[model samples]
Target: MHFVIERNRFVHDVQNVAKAVSSRTTIPILTGMKLVATNEGVTLTGSDSDISIETFIPVEEGDLQLVDIKQEGSIVLQARFFAEIVKKLPGEQIEISVLDQLSATIRSGASVFTLNGLDPEEYPRLPQLEEDLMFKLPQDMLKNIIRQTVFAVSTQETRPVLTGVNLEIENGELICTATDSRRLAMRTSTVERNDQELSFKNVVIPGKSLTELSRILEENDELIEIVVTENQILFKLGHTMFFSRLLDGKYPVTSSMIPTQSKTSFSVQTKSLLQTLERALLLSDGKNNVVTLKTLPDQQIEITSVSPEIGKVTEDLTTSEQEGEEMRISFNGKIVIDALKVIDSEKVNIMFTGAMSAFVLRPTDHKHYLHLFSPVRTY
Candidate 1:
């Protein structure tokens, strides 16, 4: 196998594919990246069993040439070393050639290095799913959905299903939900499906996978194609393809858990509330990170936090609007700050059923996304 590729383009594709390669992979060959050169273009792939990413660089894009193929073949190279070498090479182009006995030579500018290559045949094959169930979403919108929910997924592995984000599609609407039992985040969006009759439920994707995918996705209006099956999900972004294995257990039913009505409701400036909670948390117990919110007269609310070793903090914030019964609620201030940071609107609406029940937070102008937080019992 021999080929010469533009240095910058090759570096970009390598870094993207390297996101899937893990050094702790049980399979020895899985740590290496597979590169295949064909008549059309050059393909790079990396995987660690649970997730796989493949990207292609065409021989030429319009008038600019990307890759020149001397011989059409394939090779697997150590991902860690190869990526570093390519990035630091002082050259406009890199030339790679595989020699006898699975040895490869890399040359650029005045630098030359030889790396022992693994046989590409030993690499695991990526799943191939029929495009029977496929839909499209704007790249920027998909990134927003991931950012809004993936953080709320449970880190504990005890309940494997809760460590993933649940995706459900029905009647042209797609809902994504994630929860750690203590808090939950949900987002809803309309999808363009290839089949109008297609619908699915309980398709839980690992939170880690979505986090990585978000990093690679550029914020733009380009549409990304999504294909879902029983056990795997594929995200097609132009010439790149990302694949992830679905969780095996059933996701807990969460619709009944969200409160339909609130006993106390108020709208407040999102930034002001976030900053107040951050300052209050500084004086609270680090372990609990609790902050107390008490409704006052004249549409004002009091925020306070106290610690035995430290002192106390109190501040009054005037709400834009307040209604229902006056109440006091204590919750983890860190969780509220996280939810507030993701909200895009200037003001946020917070609704509480009671002091002991879960409260909901959402943007004042949007009904498609919301965050629910379970209150803490403070003495």
Candidate 2:
């Protein structure tokens, strides 16, 4: 295989694919990236079983020439070295050629590097996905959805299903939900489809894959195509393809966990509440990280956090509105702070069903996203 390519474009594509390479992969072959150069363009693939990312650079895109093919072939390059070498190449153009004996030569400007390349035939093939069940949504929208919910996925593998975000599509709406038992984050957005009756349910995508996919996608209004089968999901964005394995086992039915009524409710500036929670967290320790919220009859909300060894921290803010009753609730300060970070509204409304029940938090301006946090019991 031989090809001379635009250095910058090659570097960008390499970096993008490298995100899928896992350093701890048990399969040695999976650690390297597979590159195929054809008459059409060069395609680079990286995978670590759970997730695979493939990106293609056409020989010519519109009026731009991205790659010049000297010979059509395929080879696998050491991802660690190839990724690093591509970036530090000292020129605008890069030339790579592989010999029949399997040694590869890379040259750019005054720098020359020879690395042993592997036969591409040994690399695992990407999963074949049928396009029968597919939908489209804006890239930025999907990125936002992942950002808003992936954070809440369980970090512990005890409940593997909770380590992924559950994605469900119905009635033209796509919803993504993530929870770690103590807190949950849910975001919904509209999907575009030619078929009005298209719908799906219970597609759980690993949080790690969602986080990597979000990082791979740039902020854009361009639509992304999503294809789903029984156990895998594919995301197509421009010349890039992202594939993730769906987690096994059913995701817990989260709808029932959201409270239907509240004994105490209040609305306050989102930033103010977030800041107060952050300040209170300064005194929090361990898993408890507890913060107490006391609502005064005067409609002022007082927040406090205390540690046996450290000093207590407190803040008070006047609520814009209050209803139901004056109450006090304790919650894991860190979880609530993380939940607040995803809210994109100036004002946030929080509802408490009771001192011990799960409470709901959401932006007052948008009804599409909701966050729920289980309060910590503080006597």
Candidate 3:
């Protein structure tokens, strides 16, 4: 294989594909990246069994030439070394040629390096998914959904299903929910489906895979095509394709956990509440990280935290509106802070069924997202 390509574009594609390459992969050849040059363009692929990413660079775009193919061929190069070398190569263009016995030569301005290549035939083939069940979503909106819920996924391996975000689609609406038993985050959005009759449920995606997919997607209004199957999901962004394997177990039913009514409800400035909790968390017990919120007369609330070995913090915050029965609730300060950081509203509405029951937090301006937190029991 021989090709001369523009350095910057090549570097960008390499870094995107390298996100799937893992050094600890059980398959030896999976650590290397596969590069194939064809008549249309050059394709780069990387995978670590569970996830795979493939990107293509066309030969030319309008007036600018991206790649000049001298001969069409394929080879696999060590991902770690090849990625580092391509970034530091000092030149506007790079020329690569594969020699006999799977040896390759890389050349740039005044620099030449030889790397031993692996046979591309040994690399595992990516799944060829049919586009029967496909939908479209804006790139920026998809990124927001991942950010709003992926953090709440359980890190413990006790319940494997809770380590992923559950996705359900019906009647043109898509809902994403993630929880770690103590807290839950959910986001809902409308998607455009190719088939109006298409609907799916119980599709759970691993939190780690969604995080990596979000990192590669650019924030823009461009529509991304999503294809889902029984065991794999695919995200198509321009010339790049990302694939992830779905979790095997059934996700627990969470709808019944959300309360329809609240005994205590109040609206407060989101920033003020977030900042108060952050300050209180500094003096709270390290293990529990608990902070207490107690409603007072005249639409005011008190925030306090105390530690046996340290000092205590107390602050008074006036709510915009308060109603129902007055109550006091204690919860993990860190979890609330995480939810507040993702909210895009100036005012947040919170509701509680009782002092010990799970409370709900949501933006006053929209009903698209909701966060639920279970109170922490404190003596």
Candidate 4:
């Protein structure tokens, strides 16, 4: 295989798929990136069993000429050294050629290096789903869903289902939820689904996969195509495609966990309360980083946090308008921060029945997302 590619263009595509490559793997070939140069363009693929990312660089895009292929073949080059060498090479273009024994020579400017590559056949084949259960949404929405909910997933491996976000698509509504028993983040979006396709349920996607997907997605003029199969999920973003393995077990039913009524509610400024807690967090211990919120009349909340030896801090946060039963609730400040970041509005409504039950918080203007945090068991 032989090809000439712009140095910067090659480096960009390499970094896109490098996120999928595994550093610690029993299969040595999985550590390298698979490069396929055909008549169409140059394709780079990286995989590590759970996720695979493929990006193609066309010969010409708009006014930029990316790659020119002389021979049609594929080769796998060591990802660790190849990425570094190409990035530091001083040149406007890079020339790459592979020999019969899978050895590659890369030349640019006055520097040239020979690196051993593996046969592309050794790389694992990516999953191809024939099902048409697909949906279309702006790249930003998909990226937001992953960032908001994936952080709440369980880090423990024992309950594998909790480590993934449960997704269900039905009647044009796509709901994503994640929980680790302590708190939960739920985002419901009205996504455009295929009119002739059937709806599905219990599609648990690993939180780790969504985290990587968020990195690949940017806030741009691009729409991402989502296709789900029985055991794999595919994301098509222009000339790039991403695949992730689905979880095998059933995700817990999270809807029943949300309460039907709240005994007390407070609609306050998200930034004011968030800033109050940020200062209070300084005195909180790593084990029990608890913050107390006391709702008062006239749209005010007294926020306080205390530690055994560190000290204590308190603040009175004012809001636009507050009307609900007054209550005092203690919760993990970290979970509150996570929930606040997801809300995209100026004011967030906080609702709770008591200190022992689940509490609900959501943005006032944006009601599509609800962030619920279970109150910490405080003495």
Note the Cα lDDT for every prediction shown. Answer: 0.94, 0.91, 0.94, 0.87
Q: Which residue ranges in model 3 land beyond 4 Å of their true spot?
A: none
Better of 3 and 4 by TM-score: 3
Clashing pairs in 1: none
For all predictions, the C-alpha RMSD in Å is 1.0, 1.0, 1.0, 1.5
Clashes of each: 0, 0, 0, 0
Q: Please rank every candidate by lDDT, starting with the best.
A: 3, 1, 2, 4
Candidate 3 TM-score to native: 0.98
Give the per-residue lDDT of model 3 (tens digit) for 1-379: 8999999999999999999999998898999999999978899999998899999999998899999999899999999999999999999999999986387899999999999999999989999999998999999999999999999999999998899999999899999999999999999999999899879989999999999999998889899999999999999999999999999998988999998898999999999999999999988666789999999999999999989789899999999779999899999999999999999999999999998899999999999999999999987
Looking at model 4, the pairs that clash are: none
Superposed by TM-score, candidate 2 places the C-alpha of residue 119 at a distance from the truth, in angstroms, of: 1.5
Question: Whole-model lDDT for model 4 versus the true structure?
Answer: 0.87
Q: Least accurate stretch of 10 residues (summed lDDT) in model 3?
A: 282-291
Q: What TM value does model 1 have? A: 0.98
Instruction: Give the CA lDDT, 0 to 100, for residue 289 in model 3.
Output: 92
Error of 2 at 232 (Å): 0.7
lDDT tens readout by residue for model 1, 151-245: 99999999999999999999999999999999999999999998999799999999999998998999897999999998999999999999999
Model 4 agreement with the true structure over 1-379: per-residue lDDT tens digits: 8999988878987888988888887799999999999977899999888999999999889998888899888899988788888889899999988987488999999999999999888788888788588888899989888888999999999999899999987778889999999999999888876664557889999999989888889987478888989899999999999999999898888899888797887678788778788888988777778999888777777988989787889888886556667788889998888788777889888888887899988889976788888887777
